[model samples]
Target: MSKRDFYEVLGVGRDAGERDIKKAYKRLAMKYHPDRNPGDDTAADKFKEVKTAYEILTDPQKKAAYDQYGHAAFEQGGMGGGGGFGGGADFSDIFGDVFGDIFGGGGRRGGGQHRAQRGADLRYNMELTLEEAVRGCTKEIRVPTLVNCDTCEGSGAKKGSSPTTCGTCHGAGQVQMRQGFFAVQQTCPHCHGRGKIITDPCGKCHGQGRVQETKTLSVKIPAGVDTGDRIRLTGEGEAGEFGAPAGDLYVQVHVQKHAIFERDGNNLYCEVPVSFTMAALGGEVEVPTLDGRVSLKVPTETQTGRMFRMRGKGVKSVRGGAVGDLICKLVVETPVNLSSRQKELLQEFESTLAGSDAKKHKPRSEGFFDGVKKFFDDLTG
Candidate 1:
């Protein structure tokens, strides 16, 4: 039977890059792997086809020849297709390359020595008040993680003994397995890919080379940091097995809500209530700011919801730029709970505001009622 196109087998376009081809191959290989499919011959055959296509397309020389000749380049004994897939392509290397992230594959160390793995990264979520977030502070945090075992000096062996080479993989940390027509490399089950075994395990850590412990660390928060910001602390994560490098610790920041102020980016917003008399008569009012109380002049006949901007009163960005402004929205407050004498005086004042000058004093109410009357007249007409 004629073979299908390499691009079609991998479900990629002819102009696909190496990264794209590799990604496609990894996905298909995982789906049709013989171990995953068990006794399914169709999936095994598909896996073989995908493996061959990946091997050819990933090689620059082989891809150039195949693009020019279209499978005829490797037919018979042309470019190395005489023996097997891609003319004796190293299938073990391909399997390792595709599944390295999942399996953590590594070659044997120099002089047949075993190499320990690095530690895992960690994240810590921190909550801060708006004031503390805007103006920096230092915090001490305690984290529970794995630290190197002191009894055996992180060697995973008893005090007077050391680790021995694994008999299963012969210190190679990997073993080759053949299933049908394909050969793949996998981690050694006996050594668990460490290439060494502890004859006498450490009693403190039980041969793991690390022990659980809680550590305290101090983190300095920078000024103007907002929510969703992260501060990285290097080498503060779990300790590596044996003597490998430790991982990083990420501190995630979340700012708490404020009572009076709302923040948008670097700007700060707030609502200030003004008495109806103060709003009408134009006077200086004290407004609260992050720095201190400031005097704001209310213009004559100022309406509700009028915005006043105070320059440079907002937060200065941590990333460095111009400081933002503080925006204050005015709200005219209505008086409540009047005394009898005050009520009498207000009623008398209302009588004077009536008559022909009522529209002059309450123009908005007069215009609204006038529109309502005109609407009724039009409906009647």
Candidate 2:
């Protein structure tokens, strides 16, 4: 049978917090516990399911993977195989892993009694002009985050006073509880898994072991970076908890809209307006590019919507490809706001086109009129 969703199994929403998840799991476990259910096999299976769900949801790393990939994250060949809680695994170990402090149980100690929690990662949304994105630039940014407390050197205790071992769990950071035939371990209530209590808290950090402050950092942006690209600044995020490593800072890039140019991959596109005289007679005109103004030769009898490509005049890809071309789409602009002399000159020019070769001179216009005449004839017929 396909497994039910962990959130559904615990009867909680997807956004349920740590405390809510624990409380829900405890309620379900109590109802379906083998000790409470006696000889019911269904209840025992349910208890296993609930335990598996709680184990995955409570651990931040496991929960992140599960949230991203769903059940595939814990499958045998899928993510890491049944989340290391399947058949033949010790139930007591599973019990000890999560509920240790709850049941007043202690595990092996390390160099530091305080927990070494990783710092939170940070992201800075950076907006750059199109030209700046095409070319590399260095910038400085300010970010507000947590840093290690200097008063007690991140120990959280007042100067000259250190933390004492938890009296509840005896430095095990967990406690064991026996309910019927099962034993469960839970976090120590007194020390809350640090296994130590601070008699005097630091005045500077107020026992939080970190302070909030704004930090200035330098970021170098590489050329040809596009939207959604990010530059990683290692160890530039918030300070780690209890002397652990700091997280990474990611500067996400957003390119501002350009006035004249639109980019596609390494290529660039722009519309250049050509006068009717230039389109008909053909002449050299000045066009704008990133490299500055350049002369573009318009061929004789050039039509509107004709595209011209300038080679090696576009963007060089940040991902290392050939330099792209700039394609200019030509739009022939009709003359407007004519004076009386201009109108008389146009009328004289129109009279000159009344010759029989006029049809040959305007083949596209004659062909379109012919097609329209045939359409009306076919409809009447």
Candidate 3:
């Protein structure tokens, strides 16, 4: 039987671009693939026809000869009569070229054998006190991970014996199969793509190259490290397979909450409580800082919520810059557990100041009342 024109089989013009040719071939191949069509002989035949068309069209020399002489180029032995369905061109090759990677066939070459791979990274969460974070400290941590076995030297083979080359792929790690008009390469299933087989496996690790172990690591935390800061330790992670390079370990910092102070960037804020007498008549008081306590002078007639700034009293940033200041907000504390005599004296003092206008001493309260009055007036009107 005479064969159809290659371009006609793929539904592409003779002058179609390479990309267009590939697209047309892919569409037809997918439609008639043996896997998709099952036992449909017609679809399988169409798939072979499509693959042969693509194989010839994609090759510059083959395509030129066919274009000039048609099928006569191969029939007269000009391009080899058995070339279309033999040699590198086959059905397996077509499927591997298109679907092998998706199906886990496109791995490190050598018959699908497993190779030495990098180890997995690890994370260690470290909790830091506010003072420690602001001042910085060196801490020791114990981490459990997989380490290369010293008994077998990470080979996973017994003493005096080592892994042997895979017979299935002959140490190439991959095997080629012809499908339709193309050659497809896939990992060797017998060796699991490792290209090597261990005859005598180590009893300690059961043919695995690593074992569980604990290691101590010292980490230096720079000053001004806030929450969510991470410190990386290279090559401190779990051991890799078959003695591959180790992975990294990350130390994540979590800053503990402070009882007296809150941090905002490099600044520190604290609420300092003062007696009503101190707020009214001003005095010097001790304020706590990360370094030590310092004296802060309260001015006469100081109001509640007044902030006092102490320069260079907060944390120094890890990233080099000017030291931050400590801001203290004053909160007036009412006198509690007053005696009868003290209460009587307070009553007398309250009566003495009663006739005076409260607005002069409580301007904010007076302004709030004025706004309420205007709101009611607007509603009534």
Candidate 4:
């Protein structure tokens, strides 16, 4: 019988791509498979035709020959046989490409696979006082972590009787499954990818290979570190499986709020209250900083909310930068409680200031009243 055209056999166009050819073959093969249509002679023959067409078109070398010379290329007068082109070819690779993940096949067919996994990282939050953060300190902290089991030497085996090779996978971490023309390799169920079976488990950690322990470690905090800063301590995290590299521990720093100062980046801000007399007639006042108390000079006619900068009194950054300034914002305080004699003296002083014909004492008050008078006149107009 003259064979049908390979494209026609798979119900795909001559310009169809490799994916289209495979899809068509898959549809036809499933519809007329011998197992699906048992005892049906026509279905069995149709399955063979579809399989042969797929075998030829799927091979680049054979497909090229068939495309150029037609069936004559594989006939007795030419390239030999087109009907059985994939008889001894490697179908495992092609089958794996389509059905590998579903059946757990493909690259894992080899028995030995990596079973050890990296340990999980850990974090520890540390709170420090503003003084401690500025000066730096060393503290001993206890952390609960997983340590390798000494009884089993981290192998998850018994002290006397060690683990044995898995009979199901024969020490290979994976097992093979043959489905039609494809081969799939999946993790061994018996060994769970470890390739070994612990008949007798360790007494300390059972079969886990690691144990929980509280470890004490000394952490050194550097000076000038603020909130949200992190210090990393390598290999101080949970123990890895089967002796793999351990994870790291991150120490997160949080600085407490200060009573005397507000920090902005490297700078420090503080509000200092001054007596009205001291502000009006120039005097020296005391200011607090992280270092110590320093004297700040209040100039004559110094108004409220005047910012006086004390350089080099603020924090130096942990990441390296010039030391910042301490900004003291002045606030004028009104005096309270006056004796009878004091009140009489204040009344005399007030009269003396009112009698003056100049704006020497209260220039700001005179200017503010002048603006207010003009605002009312405009409204009336």
Cα lDDT computed for each candidate against the true fold: 0.84, 0.82, 0.83, 0.81
Instruction: Write model 1 residue lDDT over 48-150, tens digit each, in one string.
Output: 8899898889999999998999788887788845624444334345555665323333322212334677899999999999888888999999999988899
Worst 10 residues of 1 by lDDT: 101-110
- Measured with C-alpha atoms, the lDDT of residue 336 in candidate 2 is 94
Q: Predict model 4's lDDT versus the native.
A: 0.81
**Candidate 2 structure quality by residue, lDDT tens digits, 1-381:** 788988999999999999999989878876776655779989878888898888789999989998999888988776556444345534445544554422233323211244668899999999999899888899899999888898888888998998888898888765666775445565567887778788789999988788999999889999999999989999988888767788889999999999999988888899999998899899988878888988889998898999999998899978988988889999999899999999999999888877787887777888898899999999999
Model 1: runs farther than 4 Å from truth?
1-115, 177-184, 371-381
Instruction: Give residue 103's error in model 2 in angstroms.
Output: 12
Against the true structure, candidate 3 has what lDDT? 0.83
Question: Per-residue CA lDDT of candidate 3, range 193-240, in tens?
Answer: 677888899889888978999999999999899998899999999989
RMSD of 1: 11.1
**Tens-digit per-residue lDDT, 1-381, candidate 4:** 777888998999888889999889877865775555779978767776777788778889978998998888877656654334335433334344444432343322333554688788999999999888877899789999998998888888889878898898888777878877545577888988888888898889888889999999999999889999999999999999867778899999998898988888888899999998899899999899998888999999899999999999998888888998999999999878978998898889878777455367778887898899999999998
Taking every candidate in turn, the Cα RMSD to the unseen true structure, in Å, is 11.1, 9.3, 13.1, 13.5
lDDT of 2 at 315: 92
Alpha carbon deviation, residue 138, candidate 1 (Å): 0.6
Of 1 and 2, the candidate ahead on lDDT is: 1
Give the candidate order by descending lDDT.
1, 3, 2, 4
